[model samples]
Target: MDQKIPYDDYQLPVVFLPSYESPPAWIPPQERIQHPDYNNELTQFLPRTVVLKKPPGAQLGFNIRGGKASQLGIFISKVVPDSDAHRAGLQEGDQVLSVNEVDFQDIEHSRAVEILKSAREILMRVRFFPYNYQRQKERTVH
Candidate 1:
């Protein structure tokens, strides 16, 4: 036992080990099912402003679903191919942060839709965290 004690003293303590890496980047709760990048190099979750000019009686060509009315967030459920929204880079799983310079975070879903429908020129600021394409398709199916 005496001889073994000398060897034990040479071992490094746990604290001497390399520091723990930070926890994997957090993906928002709504985007959990969709795999978000651990490190967003280019975008970094910044809000992007997209401007769309739709002629009278034209659709914006995107579908949106509102989050809790009190919370103020909405999901872009779909973007029609070759539509104005499509050309504008609107993607499924993008979160709509505001419309027309007005924050929609706390607005009711129907009210937000109404605002969108009523506007001829739309200015939208959105956060896009691209999820897995396959997973997004699955969510749409069922």
Candidate 2:
């Protein structure tokens, strides 16, 4: 690692130019681009409900990973191709907020899995935060 030289040892002239004009007015939260549902119209609508009807003895067709029990909620890590979950439009990175109308916001991972496994038909509510892989790759490449 390169050593950082302290600027205090150098004798540099200080330039102080004060601005006369006032700062710009603070924009409302709804008018800002970062605010949800404000300037984001092209993205997918979040808090979407996906209904998956699983036949008897059939699998849910999705893999879940991450999130600590009773802490952070689990995520849909993978959605099997041509599966029930995929057919129902479940995407990766969907934060599983609830299962069968029961909120699992602070639910344990094992308990959440139990709840999901026990249900024949699942009514899952998910928050969709879009991820652009191509854009991310381009940024990383540069």
Candidate 3:
């Protein structure tokens, strides 16, 4: 004789499973997201405004290079330590976009230098774009 077990008498182990909602099909995968910081673009550069006040007969404490002659924008070549420029967050290789509202994008190297030296209070808009500067240097060298 065969014995049959009752369904109600059987014990089932309790299970707790984590549930995840699937992302919408319209949404792109996270792997597709573009990381902009890895690329070189004007937007990636850090733009800043630096104000330097020159004391009577005192130097601005930074040297600039590049301009129309070089087919490049004005770039800070040197920044004297503990000087007004350095203290104002100026660094070597920074491109000067403007000075006291005057555009430096296409100014001559000599004119740019003269403006920087003659100003009592220099307000400059600059950005750190070493990548472009390096590319320009390479082009000029070749």
Best by lDDT: 3
TM-scores vs. true structure, each candidate: 0.60, 0.59, 0.65
- After superposition on all C-alphas, the RMSD of every candidate to the true structure, in Å, is 12.6, 9.8, 17.4
Report how far residue 22 has shifted in candidate 3, in Å: 35
Task: Rank candidates, lDDT, best first.
Answer: 3, 1, 2
Q: On residues 107-134, what C-alpha lDDT tens digit does candidate 2 reach at each position?
A: 6667788888889889999875435322
Q: Whole-model Cα lDDT per candidate?
A: 0.74, 0.70, 0.80
For TM-score, the strongest prediction is 3
Candidate 1 positional error at 52, Å: 0.5
Q: Write the residue-wise lDDT of candidate 1 on 1-142 in tens digits.
A: 4453554577665234676899877678777655555343657467899999988889889987654542435778789999989998999878788899877776667888888999999999988755533344444421
State the lDDT of candidate 3 residue by residue for 63-120, as single tens digits: 8777886777888878999987898888877999999999999998889988888889
**lDDT for 129 (candidate 2):** 45
| Candidate rank order under TM-score | 3, 1, 2
